[model samples]
Target: MENLNNNEYQKFADKKVPKPTYLKNVILAFLVGGAICTIAQGVTNFLESQGYNEDLCGMGTSIVMIFIGSLLTGLGVYDKIGKVGGAGAAVPITGFANSIVAPAMEFKREGFIFGVAAKMFIIAGPVLVYGIGSSIIAGLLSILFKG
Candidate 1:
């Protein structure tokens, strides 16, 4: 009787196990991520052709991408895109915007100061800290080595 029960449980567990689609998911992520980078590159190239210097072109491209990301988030569309794109929707400047906007939108009901404003940095705060910290360290190293 115990053997039969064990066999039944094993069968149930086997049926419940999900087959992994890792390769397919990886391909989707890669394609989507590559597409995003290509779009950014196109924007940069267009700006450069319009007489913008390297700095201006880079900044302009970043602004455009961030704006698009924020707009999609505000319209409740970034989530859908993220679902389909996975990390393809992430690992870019747009992902940073989504990270900031998503939490703020989620907590908007708790009041502005306590909710949206506070939650807006849920992801961005740590990034800002690490970014600034790393820049500072790099700058100090550069100065030290400039002799």
Candidate 2:
């Protein structure tokens, strides 16, 4: 094992590593992402048909999608979807819900306050912080440039 030099060892290791299926992964991600968007659009359409105002329809659609994501995560289905869909499943609002719920579920053995609540935001905290921060910065810039 110690006989080979760095260059030889690197070449051996590179050959041993499996190559990724880039085209297949891309197709799966595109299909899964499109499916998620289709479901969300269906929800929005249904809400709109029920006489919901545009704002309410948007809010309701978000709520339903989040609930579906959290439910799927709890039921152990979302993880499978994530494995297959890769970033496709992780880029939507449903994926955001999964991120929030997944850590909480994993740490629930520690108790509600320290486990569930504390770990709940572990994944989504940075996202929320940066998202809100960026929005605030953008708003300020917009106002400044409004002259």
Candidate 3:
């Protein structure tokens, strides 16, 4: 190590780092994300076929998907899926569910109030706040602009 100059050390470090396989990651993300959406769509279609209205079908499907996401997270399967699917597993509503539940599960040893309840919103809290704030602002703007 002492014999190496700065440039030589830098070159050695660069070579030692593994390169990312962008194409394979992209394909995996696409397939995993597509499969998740397909499952949601299937649920929606089934609800619709049973003569439910559009709103009900959409709501039911969301509830089902969130439950599935939470269940998978609890079972420790979602993390593996996340490793394989990358952003594909994370871009869906299920990911939002995972974000809430994962932290709670991790912190549960501290007790329910300080651990699970408090930490449950660690990730999703900011998202929820921003989403609600934006919607409120948009609603106000729409009301003010109404002719």
Clashing pairs in 1: none
Q: In candidate 3, how many Å is residue 25 off?
A: 1.9
Candidates 1 and 3 compared: the better one by TM-score is 3
Q: What is the C-alpha lDDT of each candidate?
A: 0.90, 0.96, 0.94
Best by lDDT: 2
CA lDDT of 116 in candidate 3? 98
What digit string (tens of lDDT, one per residue) describes model 3 on residues 10-92?
A: 99899999998899999999999899999999999999999999999999999999999999999999999989999999988
After best superposition, candidate 2 residue 74: deviation in angstroms? 0.8
Angstrom error of the Cα, residue 127, model 3: value is: 1.5
Q: TM-scores of all models? A: 0.81, 0.90, 0.85
Of candidates 3 and 1, the better by lDDT = 3
How far residue 85's Cα lies from its native spot in candidate 3, in Å, is 1.0
Model 2, range 1-147, lDDT digits (tens) per residue?
677699988998999999999999999999998999999999999999999999999999999999999999999999999999998999999999999999999999999999999999999999999999999999999999994
Q: What is residue 72's positional error in candidate 3, in angstroms? A: 0.6
